[model samples]
Target: MSEIVYGNLLYPQDDTPDETVLGCIRGARDVGVTTFDTADIYGMFRSENLLGRALAGEPREELVLCTKVGMPTAGGPNGRGLSRKHILESVDGSLRRLRVDHIDVYTAHRYDPETPIEEVMWTFAELVRSGKVLYMGMSEWPVESITEASRLAQELHVPLVCHMPRYSMLWRVPESEVFKTCDDLGIGQITYFTLEQGVLTGKYLPGVDWPAGSRGTDLKGGRGPLMRHWLDADDALTRIQRLAPLAEDSGLSLAQLAVAWVLQHPSVAGAVIGASRPEQLHHNAEASGRPLEADLMSRIDQILGGDLIVHSA
Candidate 1:
């Protein structure tokens, strides 16, 4: 398929189309990002509606639509997980908001430990069979869980096609074994956080209030416990400073350089760009076109201290 270019439009709760996103969506369409990533619990189900309205009259066929289910929420008992209730209810709710008959890719937002895998697989298999979801995938899944999921899809005859993982210059954990596993399984790997939530963007310096202008600064659920804007900011700045010359020689911005690094991998199918505004969208789109030189990649590996890969959970 023509290189799948998608954006993670996360609105996790009644978030309005802030001026930035309104312009960003217009810019995305101006460039060539027609596919979008979203989730049921994003903005408490308001994210999809906001996106749906922004993209209201665009031709459905022109867009490759996708969304996710199975994450914690505030609604009710069926508000989370991959139980039959949540999965079925979520798909309908998502469809209603997205205003689409079928989703190109409907992913399990996370592994639902409380529910049986068989139930989740069976319910989703039926959705695919009924023509609601064109294809399916798993996100933030452990390698073993993904293997198990692949096996279940096989026995159930459902096609599990892609994997969404956090992969970037900082989070290279997927490289440990996830990339190889995906390669062996024939599942494409789509990555996000490629810039380590903008740490790799070469923007943050040793002491600048952690660059409050970044999407990473405004992420939902707060930064993870291990990674805060302040604690890691110092090291990130140092790394970027060290890598500046390499990016300079290549004539690319640090953000583009980091993204290009992720795309250089054989296992990466595509990189997901999260945009808070139009210029960022254009900037991200432009990065895909910039070629990552081999020598530059080697330099980055050295500057990042050690392997910048993420460990499998």
Candidate 2:
């Protein structure tokens, strides 16, 4: 349960070599990264498959293998969603791909409105009881769904331990509602996009074309669309430019500063980041276990401005 968890999004995508992905996973372990997060839909289940190979010969007890279901892995009505049929079927595939007997944490990749929450809860309960999945979590689920699921999970005695949400200085939607809801339910937040798809890494500058081989370059279906709003905003870039010097003064890289900022929230148990290279993993891994000063946090808020933060009910 470290402050930073590794993600496997960039792996298997962009045609990254198997050796490199394996090295990244091993490198993460060398840097003391305990938990790795991925989903079935990511790289069309190839992410988990590669992770399985990378984790070969590693101590399973020491590592937490977290993978998500409910995302479409193939073309079909039953191919996705949190339906009992899908959950039951998908867990086995994830287990097979991860090369594990059981998943440490199995999360719903997204909210499935088609299926009733009761069915989802019961299915998760069965998985936990059967030892196919140790814990249940959700990603990008609405506040209302989380509230209802919390109630049902308590009733079912299912361990809903954490929530995975997209949270960053640029993406404050979680702050508006998801964070508070999860907090009230005693669910820790292991957030993704802590670096805003590498936007906060100080690598993407305003008015300049993306550097070669960057995620912004559609190297593997870049996060361009998801981050378009922030990437295109001149004001956001200016804020990032101003924050860079402050991070340098604090003796932290911009990436480290961004990670630290997200970790400052008490409800955040960890932040998830993707790595294409071992050195990238090593650099971001440094962000964990470091506390930022309150003054610096306030300064960051000032730089981002009040309007940037979305506070929801």
Q: Please tell me which predicted candidate would have the highest lDDT against the true structure.
A: 2
- For residue 201, give model 2's deviation from the true position in Å: 0.6
TM-scores for all candidates: the values are 0.90, 0.96
Tens digit of per-residue lDDT, candidate 2, span 71-93: 77767889889999999999999
Model 1 poorest 10 in a row by lDDT: 1-10
lDDT comparing candidate 1 with the true structure: 0.75
Q: How many residue-pair clashes does candidate 2 contain?
A: 1
Q: Model 1 residue 296 lDDT?
A: 74
Q: To one decimal, what is the Cα RMSD in angstroms of model 2 from the true structure?
A: 1.7
Q: Please give the TM-score that candidate 2 achieves against the real structure.
A: 0.96
Whole-model lDDT per candidate: 0.75, 0.86
In model 1, the Cα lDDT at residue 96 comes to 90
